[model samples]
Target: MRGSPAGASFSAAAYLADVFKLKLADLHEGLVEADIKEWLVAEGDEVGEFEDLCFVMTDKASTEISSPVDGKVLKIYHPEGSTAKVGEVLVDIETDGPVAGSEAEAAPAAEPESAPEPAAAAAPAGGAGGEYDEQMITNAAGKSRRVPATPAVRGLARKHKIDLSQVAGNGKDGRVLKGDILKFIESGGAEGGLAPAAPQAPAGGAARAPAAVVPGESRTEKVAPVTKAMIRVMEEANAIPHFGYSDEITLNSLIETRLRLKPVAEAQGIKLTMMPLFIKAASMALTEYPILNSSLSGDKSEITYHGSHNICVAMDTPDGLTVPSIKSVEQLSILDIAAELNRLQELGAAGRLSRGDLEGGTFSLSNVGNIGGTYLSPVIIPGQVAIGAIGALRTLPRFDAEGNVIPAKVINVSWSGDHRIIDGATMARFSNVWKNYLENPDTMILNLK
Candidate 1:
């Protein structure tokens, strides 16, 4: 109104801006609630379209919510460290135009009839305090570790000149809580007194002294939402009857091929790894044996074969085990697959993968070999008919066709299939096809389209 055009009669209603309510929708499939990790803006602050307003940590990933319109922050419905259910209003912004999702006013928050069952007890963000310390410090090894505690707790510990790392944590995942810090100070910093232990005498031997407690004393931990989701997934997966197969695959040819093409990939700024090769080979095999990519219905009377090879790769992050998938592996070349894998790995490491990244997985693979595991009997994820685990590579001597000893690089590949549908013969045939592709890269390349 202050800057209205010279002959324009501005009505008060026309000049007034509409308030838009920013609600939290489903970030990922199966996500019911999310922890408001932090807020980047406050009420009365000016926000531009697409600007990040809040950071939310869901069971699957940590994501940033953005403002949809240019506006002033009218209100923040939920504070950081609080949980909000799907469809709940997160914030309100006053905008110039009528926003599509704008509501007249915020809806009353819904309250559950009863308290929801505690999710697999993870450390409650902020715990009994609000605002957490997100600063990361480099450890002696140059790796960064995020200290899980509120700013208040950190301040209290600092005021007392206490080293937080040495304080025994009684919170979830052994997070240092304010109460634990107080107890440590009250106990003269002696680990709040060690646990009592009774000595026992071995048969015909002198009484043995009890082992001393470690620097950080033992304490029970509450499971956070991520761990809770993991627990639920594992519990559901356990109900599926499973049968397994394991074999050592010779990977010399694959390794040679990778070495030859490494520079080509580097030129394109892609870090090519064995996983892309494995995933591509598996996808090709699934094309031939679609049954392996099928899912058994809840009633066990129907089997639905998925068209896309959305293969999931298990990743171990700070939050816990997460299996995010690369969509449509059958449609991507080895290099394309490598690029997608690299993207997923980076996002997974940063805990920023979205629901689309995690959902629609038709087959699963776990490359435990990267972390130094030799053999693994990985449990099959629910919904998928099978999952595979690859073990560490080892050089072993073997006899060639001429009976001469040759050093061969081999890795153990293990598969677990739903016993109800996938028989041993079918699984073996499928594995053989996947193995042949890896063993003979030239043939695999010919088959690639």
Candidate 2:
């Protein structure tokens, strides 16, 4: 059977008849690459159904493929450097009982080798053993054998020109692992018998050597590296016409209300903050203006409306930026949103967010204000109609109904919407509703239910 969508939970196929052998399934189609993140079970180790077998890189993100049946791994297909294409066998697994599935037909095994004549051995390389030895030497023992290492370990060795034979392998059966190579490199064991020497100032001169300069006639063009996610986001945003709306919200009442709820939240062992309030307000605003919660199809032929408010919270990870969704934000209370937000943030920062956490977002919220930005026009995430940016709250003087100026905590909210689905008037109306809810914290609490 084919693999399911990236986020959906999937199980392996059932057992088949005749105790057929199970093969390692390829997760993606490409050149076979070996950089297995985890081995579900070791050699002769038994694994249950739906167990995580291994994670492999697919020129994209690392993905985990699960075991299709309960079995023991018989053999690994590639010995680290070998690459395989999609649907190619990865490993051999031995099943206990009858194997499941119609794909259990036995394949023909290799023909038995015949004995070679003594005269053939005298003549250079005429026997079956001669051919096998030649092929093994060429394919396995040539230049590649000198670097019998895992992909990550080989990468480190090449980066520093380290000889694998010089580094001790701590992996199973003396195989070189990344950590072993790294430790060797760090301790200078792989430095070609030369102790790293410190550089001295230029001989007979107080100043350092002159800096190198490029030729004047040579023209150099600067190009920035863009990630896959960034490319998709920019392509969608530029291709789609966007309508933006900005509004300033008075945060004075909101701040006071949070302060009042703080003690109660603390007593209940929950933290009360502006984020939960903002999420609640945004959820309410989404209900009032459901059009803002919909996305435009690529052909502009249809608009897709989502029933649940899967709000994507923009988070910064060590790898890059990631937006993990808080499923059903509309159903969560202020305290519940706070707890979920904290949990998601923690998962996102640790780079432990699963595929489900990153998919199916109907709307996104980016709190750039946390980094000191007062306002920002965030790019619209692909497949999502709108993205809201929250700015830092600051004290600003504003006139009240009495026409008297007073200091208030003012926050900036910027919304970028797909013009194909949401018009300027509709976006402005949505922003107005958000502003109203945020300004009146009491209304936010009432509407949250």
Most accurate candidate by lDDT = 1
| lDDT against true structure, model 2 | 0.57
- Encode model 1's per-residue lDDT on 310-355: one tens digit a residue: 9998887555677888778888778777766655555454455555
Q: How many backbone clashes does candidate 2 have?
A: 8
Query: What clash count goes with each model?
Result: 6, 8
Off by over 4 Å in 2: 1-226, 263-272, 397-407
Model 2 pairs in collision: 15-99, 15-100, 16-99, 16-100, 17-99, 24-91, 32-83, 32-84
lDDT of 2 by residue, 364-419 (tens): 88876766677788888888889999888788899998999999889898889887
Candidate 1 off by > 4 Å: 1-32, 42-45, 73-82, 85-222
What local lDDT score does residue 5 receive in model 2, on the 0 to 100 scale? Answer: 23
